[model samples]
Target: MADIGGVNSFRSFARSWRRAASFAEVIPRRPSFVLAPEGEAVDDSSDWDMDDGRSHIDGSSEHSTAHSRQHLLRGPSLQSQGSEAIAAEFSDGASDALLGGSPSTRSSIFDVPPHLAAADVIGSHSIRYGTINSVRYRSRPSVNHDSPWGVHDEQIDPEAAAMTFGEDNPILVKEVKQGDKVVLTVEGQSTLPQSVFNSINAIIGVGLLSLPLAFKMSGWIIGLFILTLTAAVTAHTGKLLGKCMDYDPSIVTYSDLAYVAFGTRARIIVSALFTLELIAACVALVILFSDSLSSLLAGFATATSWKCICAALVLVLNMIPLRWLSYTSILGIFSTFCIVCIVIIDGLVKKDAPGSLWEPARTHLFPSNWMSVPLAYGLMASPWGAHSIFPSIYRDMRHPHKWERAVNTTFSFSYALDTCLAVVGVLMFGDGIKDAITSNILRMSDYPESLTVVMCIFITIIPLTKIPLNARPLITTADVVCGVHREHAHGADAAAQPSALVHGVRALIRVVVVLVLLGISILFPAFDSVCAFLGAALITLISIILPISFYLKLYHKEITTRERVLSWFLLVIFSILGLVGTIWTFLPKQLVAA
Candidate 1:
């Protein structure tokens, strides 16, 4: 009886052991490689295959395998140790073939995530996760050979590339380098509607006020044709500029386009031209301010005194951060739109007033003075020179793909406003129209007092607001030239308080710039001449010539024959207009009148 009881106990014990073993096999365990302590024996016959899920034939003797395992365990550093361990596990008879590198070289496998570590690890038993062949580990820097900016095989800048591809949503990426480190920054994007508003605001400025005089000089027939042609060509070039950016993500400014198409010399030349254009615009603003206020404050002060007042105000107001200025910039658009409405309403209501269409007028179907036609063309072209800012607007957009739509909408709205003002001014004032349409309205009697007050307020406010805005680029360029900008540009130093000396220097430079602009305004207060010259010379190059030239140079191979023809034709026409206008600028008004 005792022997039988002992046998039953042994049987029960055996059954319990079997059940425990089965349960242990069923339980899921985190997958990991088992490593032996230093100098321990490693199994040469693979217990579990690390590759091919089959028994690994250790064609390398057991001694060699053990020696390699020991070497991997004693790797120089933690990162390197991890690399060697991976290479050892993946190694076959030809270790280099399996490791994807030489035995002495470290593997990039350590740089990959665990899941991605399964890539090319076919049927491996050590790692049971499903394998993916799609995303392979990249051991080399990515080179973009197809950049439209003519930068070929250029290794993408890591900081800039991170900004470009690291995010899910599109962003305006910038990189600031300090010492040896790089800092990346991203700015929030503007929506389509916001972009459209900004684009329109850029287009509609003091230029709109001069269009009436522009029409008077060009005549109704020639004026309308030139206006239409200029708008269409400039808008098209703006679109081309956006596409150029699309082809090369690195380009962030108009000058960058020039650099890619040509070289550093081109970049410097383009930047200098753009700088001159901005300075000219600042001069125009001063003239516009003085003219508007001088007309309003008629016997109280001369235009020179008003110009001095404007300079003082600009120097003070520019001290306000550009961010705050941008917020108030929307008022400029509203002011301009209001001025247009007042002009249309006043012109229609006072139809029988002096110089109205009902009166005998010197309205010309063609330019009475053929020499003035170039001047007229320049005036008409002035308002369309918003191309410099298009790249900035494009960069700020949330949906950059919708850029063409925004361009079309902005140009269409601007054109309509321009056309409305031009037609009404010609009909109401005929040859009596002053350079500023508002000046014409202000001089006439029976004009609604409320409308005149509104027009005066709007026109005067515009130049005051625009002066600092237009001068912003020059101020920044000054900062760079003075060497103060670099001290602040360092990313690590961004939060550090700027020195008072730097502040004082910047203030002094700004004062000098504003004072110089004041002198120019006082020296050459011919508002129409300045506007016409800018339209004829700078605007033609920036808006018409540069964009088309850059586009042709960048996309010479890809662009169709039709596009090529149209681009060259525009180049020819605008080149003539620019040259003629330049000649008109230098010619004496007395001589031209004769």
Candidate 2:
């Protein structure tokens, strides 16, 4: 036999074993190279076929020199050294070919950096880090640039290429943008019915009180046309505003929509408008409160004292947490019902009572001239000033996609009732109607003082209730712009509770906001003056321009030519209305009267 136990035979076996071990390849624990699964074999067929498809390769490698032939044959055995002594099986001539890389990769093996070469080991079962042909890998044939035709080649992110998606997964993919996948979770989202009613209440606010005056300023023929037209147009605007939110689900306020449509300048302009509107609204509220309570008390309290009392009441009322406001909105429904009853009843009473308390009935079919058209046009736009909060209502619905239904329902009810009130009040009282239909009732009434006080209280409460609803959006938009809102948003990963300091700071901000508004109310107590300023500027922007611009920018291609023409027409018309109203705002009270 072959010298079974002799020292010389033993020494020869040892030499051959050491030679195999010297070139044995294995996976090494390195940071850059991902590890293959334990005990999994390297895929030999999928990787470098001595034909890794990069650079020049002629199929005539079959007729290549002995050196190339040796390389092609030895590459597999050298690469297949997963857990076995594979390199040993490769011949010494083949070993030289294998170590020298491929005809396509390079002729030299020393191309591996000195630092990398120093770290390289074989037979340790450590993963090899090198390129063969065009393929590069860590542990196994995780990447395969090799092609059956020896044609195309591409590199993958190594971490990506290393993923073995497993037998269950046929491919791998990743997101292009991460935040696009994040979902929004608005707290206190209303059920469909509640949301609809909340929208109704929001849409049918103090603006309805002015429509009869609009009917007087514009002719009844023009007034009715403009009134219905404004409703239809603004409702469409509300729809456009809602659709813009689809561009980004993260939008939570009206100003945010502005931010997305334009940029920082637009955002700041919108924020400034909202802030301005809120301050004006609070001023209106103070004026309303003082007027209502003074009307209630008659000789008992001064207007200034009534304003102070109303301010105190407002401060207390606003302190009620937002969570409770949803329930308070039901109170708004009652307020609407009572005000409607009061209007109808007071009209009946005025018709029956002595005409001495009312104005001499001289109703104008058209304006004495055209200066009044600005106020009339502005009045039509003003009723739908609820556009700012429309998105908030839509967002807080359970099925937000059906928001248009809620909007339509709101406008339908508000319009029907407002039209009734405007036509009836103007016709019954004639030119006797005050800017507020209720003012007619207050003036013409020979009613019980108890009824007058009750009417005053209801009038006061209606405007008072509106302040917080308006202020919330302003506060929310401020938070968003200032970067406090994102932190405040209660994400799934958010902290369980805010720190006490955070709560205190938030409370302080709310106080500061309310105090600033209170100061504005005190300084500019002329409610009509404030209304004219905002009606000209802020209301026109929210009700007309912003919505028109958003729809045109986002979906101009989708809109029909006719629709686009009509939209542009309205945009131009409203732009002019906004300008005229702005000029009208600066006119003397005498000029407005003219």
Candidate 3:
């Protein structure tokens, strides 16, 4: 009831404890330790405060006590008492007790027992044990900044904190003792289903549109095998990222884990890959929008006008803050579902209209060379694809360990739909499937007006849905590189917000990135090569290489010989896939075909 558990309240309680002790020497608080229940000690961190990143207990207790009055009982030498209890109340429950209703509330300062200063916290780095009336506490930080992967104490449940220590009953809410470890199981932010949906939204991207092309190029048997295999490997890599996160619970990004495993260089490489992929995605999205729109309204607007319109749309979309854009992922689910419907419709239309879709193009079961394999890989992987967002999605999930399920679920659902579309397109139109299956629908179908409208919706909404989701990674990368953390601003702590200048710079960066991508998209209106290149190069690198690197590097002892050999084999194989695929994609069509 006294708000004694708060950081400020703890300071006041400590000050009052010193004052009540009639101490002549005032010790200024300077990062004192919190006394463990059975003599173990732990450092007091800033996690005590809900929003602020500042620690509550600062300055020496001696200095704080010098200015205080002693609230002491004249009767007993409490040193004679064998056992003492220190009630550590929770901030969540303390207000009710402090409101003067709970029988357990200390009515007077003297209600606190003697030997309240039992802790060894009189000096630097030593915790002072205390027999307090009632003090509140919060969970500690998940990991240390320097040794992020080290075994550290994690915050336990408030209910669990109520249990007493052994041999001596003291401390109401349980605090972490030396060597005590707990996995943080934070909940109530997002539901499991929403997390699954989010994972799906993140993993499913523009790649789905071109899956049929992958099947067309790689042969239906090989293409289907590669797609399924890619999904399994992608899911495996996603789980690897999850395992990396387990080393440090505070790690919220892939780069953070990279820093943990390989230090600064790895982090920078991950960041660079992340930024480039997002930028590439931005360029692809712009080109996709312009190309699709230009195709739809061929006579209505010029190609330049379509490019301008697409650019303007992206500019407007990026204006929305990164957090609010999550709904777009949900919208992406709808768009993806619509595209699936369109794929099925395209197959059905083929039965009635035969060659009514548009001018026919030849279908091929194989590209002229094995190098063309990267084309399919690029279509599916797209320069590493959405694995970058896996950590963010996992961090939001209710059960962190269940991330594997989410990953597998996302891959399964997305691949099933994609496979259906891909197979349908490849079967109906054979190798005539365009880079985007939607193109097949447009150029190869002679459906009714209703079908056209549905097809248009599929085309328009799918890209629009993809825009914000794809741009999210780029916006986030910019925010990080630009030296600002606006996400903290929206939280309970205002001080965590960056300055106006930083926000301005972030906005400027976002603007320049969009403009550059627009220019690039306009310059190279056909983005198929860019997509293929990114998929062949970075997708192979990220999806195959990086995960293997992390696992083989970080978990050498945990993994076995067979696992190691397989990992190395994959590394060599995918590295070849990436290199050959990239070179194959950039070659002239005649050379590539021959």
Candidate 4:
């Protein structure tokens, strides 16, 4: 009985051992398995055999079997189709291939998640994940790949990818078409508007009668003076502009002119001068607008309120960037040109008009002769003769060689217009030019309607665009002077040292100069006095004096002795004449108060 019990126990132990070994062989030691679930496996033998149209075993197989039987030859192990055992066998083969000899030969194919295998195949050319494949093919990452999934891959076509993505992007594909190319087509552009064309024709048809409508009442002498001043100032500014262009080869402004003329130290001086000028301009505008509005609108308007509004508008305009302000200046120029053209046409065509548009009547066109000179001079200097802005204009011209042509054209045009208007005013109004000329054309017209008011507003607003251009130098100067005390210093290591402080101090000095000017304007608030004083003082200094000084300084070596003497003589004459004229005009008896 004991022997039989021992035999049964040994048999059971052997059976248990055999079962454990089978399990170990069938199940891999890995933590995860990639084979299909136990019940999901399907035999692929019938499918493969049917596709071949051949028997699984054949006569060749019989012959191979006989040879194998004779030699007991061993062949590669074949796994059962779709079986877990087959999957394990394939996995082992792949692992062996990856890590066969060199470690570098190893691959991640076997380690890749089965679920992502399809994605890998489709996106293999992408940079984000296909760098390995690209390296295998070309030994470098492809740069042309633009697939989001393969951002690092270069093999893919970026243009193709962009087109695919861009198809859905509206902002990327917007296009503008040329409207009309034919010069004489119905849709073609006409240089002037219909209203302007009609006005021009009407004025020309009426002869001298249109002079009243044009309000050109100042007289030929005043007109000639304005023309001369405009031409001289423009010529001087253009020359300076040319020099500035040689230095920077880029668009510059009045501030830039200061920098070029005086070095970085000039920034503050220019800025202070500009700021003061703008403040004065703004105040003047407010006062002018308020006075006009109070008279026109009666109870609805007050000088104080209009002044506030003008101040606010100036501040808002100044806050705008320099580029925008430049655009505004261009606009102002265009508007002024148009208005001047209209006025000239009216004056040239008018018949039986008031003897000189300046003569006292229902309404006067030109301001008093005393005021007209300074006002016209200031207007010309403000925009057309802005010497400080010359450098920038010079820099932007495509053909710097043609700069003289542009300058000549601009000044010539300005002179013709200013002279015509002044002559017409004086011819029409005689001694009454002072009473006729007002802040706007409408103010000089009998009917003073909405159109006139609108035109006046537009024309006046245009010049104010230059205020910021004038103010920048002051700010820069302030920075230079006061910024040195700060913890950190700018431009200290360069050849030029911190001139910003110096500039700032200069700006402060300019501020004082501007304040003095304002005080003078306020004290002698008469329009005629302000115009004459400013024209004689500011225009003469900026136009004649400065130009001569700069030219002498810049070309001293090249200038002949006679030229030098001439320059000095001209400078002294201009200074004396300017001083005398300014003083005479500002005298209480001669002044025409605003």
Please report the candidate that would top TM-score against the real structure. 1
- 1 or 2, greater by lDDT: 1
- Candidate 3's residue-wise lDDT over 1-594, tens digit each? 555655335343332222111111012111111222321223323233212211111232222122111211111222223233222312221233211332122121112221232122211121123322122344443534422223343343323232221111122212221122221111212345556655665566666667767776787556767777777777788888777655433344455445445544565577567666766666776666666666666688876677677667767777764334544445655766776776676556554433323432345555535655667776766622666656655654545657777777777887787777767666666655566666655553365657656766655665565565466556554554444524211113323546779878887877776677778777766566777777887777766688778777656666789989988988888788778878877687566541
Q: Of 2 and 3, which scores higher on lDDT?
A: 2
Q: Please, what are the lDDT tens digits per residue for candidate 1 over residues 383-460?
A: 997787677567556567789999999999999999988888887777788877877777665888888888888877
**What local lDDT score does residue 340 receive in model 3, on the 0 to 100 scale?**
75
Q: Measured by TM-score, how close is model 3 to the native structure?
A: 0.65
How close is every model to the real structure, measured as TM-score?
0.68, 0.61, 0.65, 0.48
Q: Which of 1 and 2 is ahead in TM-score?
A: 1
By TM-score rank, best first, the candidates go 1, 3, 2, 4
- Best by the lDDT measure: 1
Q: What is the C-alpha lDDT of each candidate?
A: 0.61, 0.53, 0.52, 0.37
Predict model 4's lDDT versus the native.
Answer: 0.37
The local lDDT score (0 to 100) that residue 208 gets in candidate 4 is: 20
User: Candidate 3: lDDT of 354?
Assistant: 36
Candidates' RMSD to native:
22.6, 24.7, 17.4, 33.7
lDDT at residue 332 of model 2 (Cα atoms) = 50
**What tens-digit string does per-residue lDDT give for candidate 4 at 236-315?**
54565464333322112444334334433444454444444334443343444455554555577554665455444554
